[model samples]
Target: MEWDLKVIDELPDYMKMAFLILYNFTNEMVFNDEMKRGDVPTSIQCYMHDTGISEDEAREHIKHLISESWKEMNNENGDHNSSFSKEFVHVCKNLGRASQFIYQYGDGHASQNTLSKDRIFKIIINPFPYKL
Candidate 1:
């Protein structure tokens, strides 16, 4: 789905800043993953370019958004509605765990020079030489 910029523009400045931070952070993650360069400076530059905000402002807002997201995720863990099955909840937890492992040291999943590459190789390329 595409984002409606019109709706986003209607938000208050603080809310707009938060949304911009989140959007730029997501873009940074994707770009870094694809480029195999966990370059925070590039991401910050992108945020500044897109939001017309100072680097300090972008950094502060991005950090705030990240902190808020973690708090929300922590609160939601194991507290889903009845519509979500146990298996689905388990999968969600596993996804979060995998994301944490992969990004624990920058864009490790994308950069071959990082420890993530070795971990990924062990997990996907050189699995245990035994039948499950």
Candidate 2:
């Protein structure tokens, strides 16, 4: 898959690495069609397990990137500084296990009922503009 990333180098070091891994996994999974294979592991989950990041950390990182990308894409044209949060979300939903789970559950899933919609709404709508 050819990457046309214009702002990758601008990403924070850790985030850049994470995004690369996520992108690679997304490509591999899509090309291999592994999701159709029963019991096949998603790339995002495999990456977290291999990297030894807690599940929560992996999920948080993926979500953060998605939020940032969305913010950037929705901003006015020529805003190169816009966050690439949507791109991140796109990558994760395409390859990450957490995203897979979310899709599987959908909006009406009881599993998500434990989370407060108010809190999640805030996170989804308001991503930190810059990584600290």
Candidate 3:
């Protein structure tokens, strides 16, 4: 299920959906082996556009996720790692698949305008190695 819909339904409606976006963003970046230490503004925009949320909310949510995770990843002396929550990663993988499907065959539906432009640029600049 989409993280936004799931989080919205599972958590209290008043709860911010940005948390879901941040969770997915951080999980995706780490899982995909990206070097970026934190979520990017472009990624935030994509998540917000996809879920119909606000930019500030998205940034706040990402900060919340990263801050909490940092607490666990850091040692007493304040060290870090290329680590993340497994449960959140699983949720993000599922969310990524759902989002990909929507983008590939959304047919100009709700997600048409919500597609990630940054990702599109990356794809264009560095096309995938193989044809599927």
Q: Under the 3 Å rule for N, CA and C atoms, how many clashes does model 2 have?
A: 7
Worst 10 residues of 2 by lDDT: 102-111
lDDT of each: 0.56, 0.47, 0.44
lDDT of 1: 0.56
Collision pairs in model 2 = 66-85, 68-85, 69-84, 69-85, 69-86, 70-85, 70-86
Estimate the lDDT of model 2. Answer: 0.47
What is the alpha-carbon RMSD of candidate 1 to the true structure?
A: 7.5
lDDT of 2 by residue, 1-132 (tens): 356567788865334544554554343324223344443454446657888897567656656655565444334233245465656544543443343333332222223443434344444656455777
Top lDDT: which candidate number? Answer: 1
Ranked candidates (lDDT, high to low): 1, 2, 3
TM-score of 1: 0.51
lDDT per residue for candidate 1 within 1-132, as digits (tens), equals: 134557777753334444554454454455545445544445556678899998678767666766665555445545344465666655654554455565555445444556766666676789677777
Q: Which tens-of-lDDT digit does each residue in 20-111 have in candidate 3?
A: 43454444333222324343345556667788887678767656765554343332221134254555544543443444443442223222
Flag clash pairs in model 3.
Answer: none
- The prediction achieving the highest TM-score against the true structure is 1
